[model samples]
Target: MQRHSLSVSELTEPDVVRRALDALCREVDGEAAVAKTALRKRSAFSEVLGAAVGKGYFAENPLARVKWQAPGVSEEVDPACVPNPTQVACLLTAVGRQRGRGPHLEAFFGCMYYAAMRPAEVIHLQISQCHLPKSGWGMFNLSGGVVTAGKEWTDDGAVHEVDSLKR
Candidate 1:
């Protein structure tokens, strides 16, 4: 019960579809898309092609014949991209050299490097929670962080809401 001609065309070619999908697999910076994102796009495209076939626009799903696979996800970070302590110190120093906001952010970045605190946690840090002394080292009693959500998505209509620290 097909309404359209069965002739193959450039738009529906399997090779063309494969190439377009391959392009989608890589980001603009040439990095591969995350596994979950790529897989979701693939599934969505497949459904679209299935609908086209069901409506008699295509003879079959072209992607069904492609053998390409998405890149695997990994938790291991590349060591080369990691900055050493000296590099971090130099970066913090450079940040502190900026005119207006630099001096303020120097301590913020220091908390991230020295205490290994997340940006959110540092954002929510209070002066009262700091145990700074006239001595060697100081301590911070971190409680939670501030999470930004859309106003419509929040119960109180505030964009920034206090949330517990992530485990």
Candidate 2:
């Protein structure tokens, strides 16, 4: 719920509020299937709590006082999951061979390799955004890109939608 309209003076006591926050943390912990899941949720919850306190809905953020420790989990990206140079080349070759593939796809891969563009940015590219010179090699205008929330696609996730490349 939005915190702007909430009034701490009319709400429950500070101790009661603290206890409620504690209960919510416990509930989140219990429902979370993984430590990372719990950690992420708690992090966002803490932000909301902070906002509530800032709006004078509460004297202090109870979440600030509580110590949250997430259990250890592997944070490292798996080496096997990453594509080697040869694999990448083969994939690129395959993408190049697809029938009726537009120049955009080739340019997109070029951006991925040369400009180190993320996939979302490549997909959102427009033809008019590129700056191919009349004499020299072309250059891509990648001032915009898409980003997913929490490493997965969601309906409510934000995407950088650009109508035109910036001049």
Question: What does the lDDT come to for candidate 2?
Answer: 0.62
Model 1 residue 128 lDDT score: 95
Residue 104 alpha-carbon offset, candidate 2, angstroms: 3.9
Worst 10-residue lDDT window, candidate 2: 158-167
Please list all clashing residue pairs in model 2, or write none if there are none.
Answer: none
TM-score against native, each model: 0.54, 0.42
Candidate 1 global Cα RMSD: 7.6
Q: What is the C-alpha lDDT of each candidate?
A: 0.85, 0.62
Output the worst ten-in-a-row residue range by lDDT, candidate 1. Answer: 1-10
RMSD to the hidden true structure, all candidates? 7.6, 9.8
For 27-115, candidate 1 gives per-residue lDDT tens digits of 78998888878888889878878988898888888787778887777768797998899999999999999999998799899999899
